[model samples]
Target: MNNTDHTTATVEPAIRLESVTKQYVGAETVTALADVDLPVYGGEFLAIVGPSGSGKSTMLNLLGLLDGPTEGVVRLGGRDVTDLSETELTDARREYIGFVFQDFHLLPTLTAVENVTLPTAFTDGQYADRAVDLLGRVGLGDRLDHTPDELSGGQKQRVAIARALINRPEILLADEPTGNLDRETGVTILEEVRRICERGVAVVAVTHDELVTEYADRTVRLVDGRLGEGDDGFAT
Candidate 1:
């Protein structure tokens, strides 16, 4: 097996957040996440559930390392990441994390395969080939030449999922990934995500739909910027 495979095998939790807080300075000010602590183990599927303005998206952004915490620390594979320099953090994000958004975020002009292999821009040789294999696995082999506009919503989302898998990320952070799909399409996407988790990639998703929760092995609820207990959608 490759060294990357070996490394992932040895890791404990893929992601861990300790007393994380995020604040926004819009209009006046707002606290999005308040001292939230979470741990996501490798090879597990986790769901973050809440209503609008419940800090679900904020937590996903934090997990993706797209935004830094206003307080506390975030650790990936047991290493603290909050204090890294911007460049270091950027490198870490590229090497360790993958993201899928509700919008599918594909370039309008790029072919589906090109979109899936976009990570090659930051990575090198072998990973580029790996991206191609990922696209095939997502059942997009015949749609490789099609652009986002030419594909159906489900197809586009499949390409996005393959793109997220290109980096071989230990943790997959998806934010409302099925929000734009119809019920049947949403279930298809969730099943694909569940397949990824079954292959040992940790999948962390933030979703409000109750149907989606059935795919998660564990569900953590957030409310008013705080972590809550059980399924009532309130953070303690």
Candidate 2:
């Protein structure tokens, strides 16, 4: 390879896996991800799609740092996550990762603004204030004081998204973020996701919904713990 090729190869992937394999042992052993190699760049919207038990959610969880692989290396921005201690992994998650989920997991007791600001408690000065600003930016300024029950489903989702963005992470990992919403509401949430990607946050969402791919910059299909054929696509 030429020097340019070497340089390109050295460039960091925002999220990456090399020969990654995941397995669970119960009464029997099951492989959830097998010899997977994937890369996500710094500013892309990538969707992971597949049927049930196809490893889509497992991939998301691993990328989100919610779980570690049984074998192989996982890297974030060139850092080797697999080699990190538990405390280091926890700190890395706080500093570099954001997560959004389908169920709109907002605390019913807290207001929207509080929900967004909650994570900031573990962070430093001005964190709470920044969370409030994020909520406002997500168009929740008027609903800041509303609890989950006081808001519409979509509004609650908006709050959940704002909460995810509170730390301004480099990558946003969303697991079936629209699964609980109606079609229109789902689109609205996805549009917000697209907006986040526009701002240069890499977004990876796991979903079974084909309509969601329309918003993604790239689509990857997983099947039986492997990357399926012809699963790669660029924006048309």
Number of backbone-clashing residue pairs for each candidate, in the order shown: 5, 0
Summarize candidate 1's per-residue lDDT along 152-223 as a digit string, tens digits.
898899999999988778889998888888989889899999999998888998987776788888888887
lDDT of 1 at 122: 58
**lDDT score for residue 95 of model 2:** 75
Cα RMSD of predicted structure 1: 3.6
Cα lDDT of all candidates, in order? Answer: 0.84, 0.83
Judge candidate 2 against the unseen true structure and give its global Cα lDDT, from 0 to 1.
0.83
Model 2 lDDT per residue over 96-205, tens place: 78888888888899999789877677667686677678888878888888899999888888898998888778889998888888899889999999999988788999
* lDDT, residue 142, model 1: 80
In model 1, which regions exceed 4 Å deviation?
1-11, 122-128, 232-236
TM per candidate comes to: 0.90, 0.91
Cα deviation in Å at residue 64, candidate 2?
1.2
